[model samples]
Target: MKIAVVGCTHAGTAAVKNMAELYPEAKITVYERNDNVSFLSCGIALYVGGVVKDANGLFYSSPSELQEMGVNMKMKHEVTNIDTEGKKIAVRNLETNEEFEDTFDKLVMTTGSWPIIPNLEGIDLNNVVLCKNYQHANHIIEKAKQAKKIAVIGAGYIGAELVEAFEVYGKEVTFIDSADRILNKYLDPEFTNLMETEFENRGVKLALNQAVTKFVGREGSVEKVVTTEGEYEADLVILC
Candidate 1:
């Protein structure tokens, strides 16, 4: 039997490794656009803040590791289009700009959610980044070294934790969100108030009820974070 997996991230990697072990006689082909596989995106902020000593810890698997289990892992191959009716697919090799078609007896799609880019002005700024992967962790840490003031949008778990991490690195952080209170979705108002007060006391600005309308930048790098409340000078911006 032959099986084809569409992705190699968290869910996909887990599925492939389990299937390969359970069905040793089967031929497995895994397609991943990234050169590496099985990376823990959740630890990106910790890695950025130096809590994670080694960046290699972010990845749990590699193409060579999967290959050792008798799996054919193809890196830098993007599954551009799928024809489920025909059990065929169109793949593009990002490095060579080459395209081809392949057929499989069984197919699995583990395509993950992408970061929701807000329809705000100046989103194309250079210093603005999304903390979603290992590469992003490295770049965010490098950016923080030179940033005097940083602004993080969204007060979700990742956003809140990042604010605390960036603060430890001596970067002034302002967290902006449109909710009436911080972490309104998670904890009770009392707990949220306590956490919010602590964040504020730590010098991390909490701008609740304020929605960012635009990102002001000069020379393609973010300079100010503009919201309905007002504008705050920012040397770096992080979107979780």
Candidate 2:
């Protein structure tokens, strides 16, 4: 049997590694758009907080490592289209922009969630980014070095943790969320209130119950965030 796997993040990496070990007799192929794989995006905040000194430590697996396990690892390749009935997929080499077809007896999709980018004014300005991948994490860290004030949209785990990191790094942080409290989907008011208080104590401004209407910029860079309630200055913005 021949198996083709698309994506090599948390899910894809686990699937491919387990399959290669369990089904050694079967031919396995892995496709990853990134040059590296198995990055723990959850550790991004830790990296930003200076707990993790090296960004290379974020990745758990590499293309060569997968190849050593007798799996065909195709890095920088994107599976553009999959024909389920024909058991074939159209693969594109991102580096050379070349396209080709590959047949497989079975196919697995481990494509992860994408960061939702809201349509708003000045959204494409410099220093406005989304945090979801290894590259994004690195970009955030590099850009944050010069950012005096940082704003994070979405009060999820990633956003909350990121604000904490920025606060620890001595940057003024503003966390904006449409919800009434941070991590409302995961924690109760009692617990969330404690976290909110802690954030406030650390000088992290909470902009809860406010929906970001648009971004105001100057000199091709985001300078402030406008919401339903008010506007806050931000040299860098991250959408979590």
TM-scores of the models, in the order given: 0.96, 0.98
Model 1 deviation from the true structure expressed as Cα RMSD, one decimal place: 1.3
Local distance difference test, each candidate? 0.87, 0.93
Candidate that would win on lDDT: 2
Q: Tell me each candidate's RMSD, in Å, in order.
A: 1.3, 0.9
Q: Which ranges of candidate 2 are over 4 A from the true structure? A: none
TM-score of decoy 1: 0.96
Q: For this target, which candidate reaches the highest TM-score against the unseen true structure?
A: 2
Q: Candidate 1 residues 1-240, lDDT tens each?
A: 878999888888889889998999988998888888888887877887889999888888888889999999888899999898999999999899899998888998987767788988899898998987667778888888899999988887778888988888888899989897877788899899999989889999888898899999888899999999999899899987
Query: Per-residue CA lDDT of candidate 2, range 1-240, in tens?
Result: 999999989999899999999999989988889988899989999888889999888988888888999999889999999999999999999999999999999898998889989999989999999998888988998999999999999999999989999998899999999999999999999999999999999899999999999999988999999999999999999999
Query: How well does candidate 1 score on lDDT at residue 150?
Result: 93
